[model samples]
Target: MRRPSLNDLAAFAAVANHRSFRRAADVMGVSRSALSHAIIGLEGKLGVRLFNRTTRSLSLTQAGATLLARLDPVLQDLDRALDTLSEERGTPSGTLRINANKSGARILLANVVPRFLDLYPDVELDLVSEGRLVDIVEQGFDAGVRLLEAVPQDMVAVKFGGDVRFLAVAAPSYLEGIVPPTTPDDLQAYRCIRQRLPSGKRYRWEFAKRGAEIAVDVPGNLTLDDNDLLVQAAADGRGIAYVPEPFAEPLLKTGQLVTILDDWCPPMPGLALYFPRSRHVASPLRAFIDLLKRWDGAR
Candidate 1:
């Protein structure tokens, strides 16, 4: 059998890891049709099918699974070997892919990203922001940014920023001539702009005061996804909205919104940069982490 090229093997790995031709193509900076043709060529060379395809789903065949299991470590070792050359040259040059939630992305953009880019001009940083939590390894991300508490047990987490607080806020007009909620249960008597999570479930409002904690399945006529939208709805007097304090800070300063039950909201663990514990950290990722720590310390 003719040997397949390393590029084809890497392409196969990307598709296997992401389980989507489109996502793999995006990561590889190639067109979907081109990636598909490459895979077809690779399969012809190996004389074995690698993937099971359907209109709605994609999965690996047994041969493909076995190939991936063996290929992952080899590719990782190759990456480390190549990274060594960059390290010897006293420069980190590579693409660094990070999957981050919207809030985490905003924080990094405001603090770490700009400096990191300036310091390592050769490093291509791919930062994808989304609301859904993804398996960083399976998604082919060098690292992930998420709330510290959400980091997987097997991953190493570098906590940064600071504690976060979720606040229940409402427009002053909405509170006019009406009694504001003093306790979690009082939300039952008011309209709330409910939050829909990425998983399609309503987010339960959480509160803490002293030693007591409560989670309220808030009632609402309007349910929306995304923190910004929730904050805007509250500012428009649609209803009370529970969101991260940062999201409502601007409106609160302008008197468009006011915090209610201030004592109930307490700070919790903030965002962290997390990576697989078993993988070797590449030079680019190492430099980025160092910069992240510096920025975090300065904050």
Candidate 2:
């Protein structure tokens, strides 16, 4: 029996993860032919076909799948241990990838991230803003920020901000001479600014008062996916916009926006930072979480 080369095993893992020689090559920073040759050489030595290659696609054999299942975590642990060592040196330095729901990111930008960056200039932060929720572990993100209600209880959760909710608002000109609706059901009579969800359909405007929740499928002349644009349109007298409380706050303060159906807009939940428990907490992530926890306490 002979010991297999670590390089060959790494190539096998790369090919298995990417499911393509070209993509594996791109990730590993090698030529496609070189990556294919490495796989072929390993297969020849082991007397097993690790992948079933077709003209247009690649699929792993049973042996390849089993091998990948074992190597994936081993490689992940190796990387995590290396990052942990770097963090222990009194400098929180590493790439910290974060997936943030729109409002969550907004709050962080205003309140938290600047101070973190100022303290740890060595750390690199990759921030992605998205409307839909993403699985951070599967997507290779270090952490994610979402509404507390949106987070799964299994993950380690850190509350970051105070409770924030949505508010239905309209322009002064739009409400002038028009009776505002007292009940959520009454919104059907007025012009509504409809918002579309990321899933390619209109979002139902949700309202709650006295322990009863109602989702209103109202009519509208304008429809959009972005809350910012919808709020602007509503402020310009197009119709009522169902906007998150923080976004409408400054405008409401300045009398640029007027609230409607306030009682129906009850506070749901604020933001929470979450991550997988299995992975090692990188130093940058630890510091960021500490900062967030302190920020929450201060608020």
Candidate whose TM-score is highest: 1
Clashes of 1: 0
Q: Write the per-residue lDDT of candidate 2 for residues 9-85, one digit (tens) a residue.
A: 89898788667787678656799999989999998887888899999989999988887898878877887787767
Instruction: Indicate the residue-level lDDT of 99 in model 1.
Output: 97
Off by over 4 Å in 2: 1-60
Stretches of candidate 1 off by over 4 Å are none
- List the candidates' TM-scores in order: 0.94, 0.85
**How many collisions per candidate?**
0, 0
Candidate 1 deviates by what RMSD? 1.7
lDDT of each prediction vs. the true structure? 0.94, 0.86
Pull out the clashing pairs in model 2. Answer: none
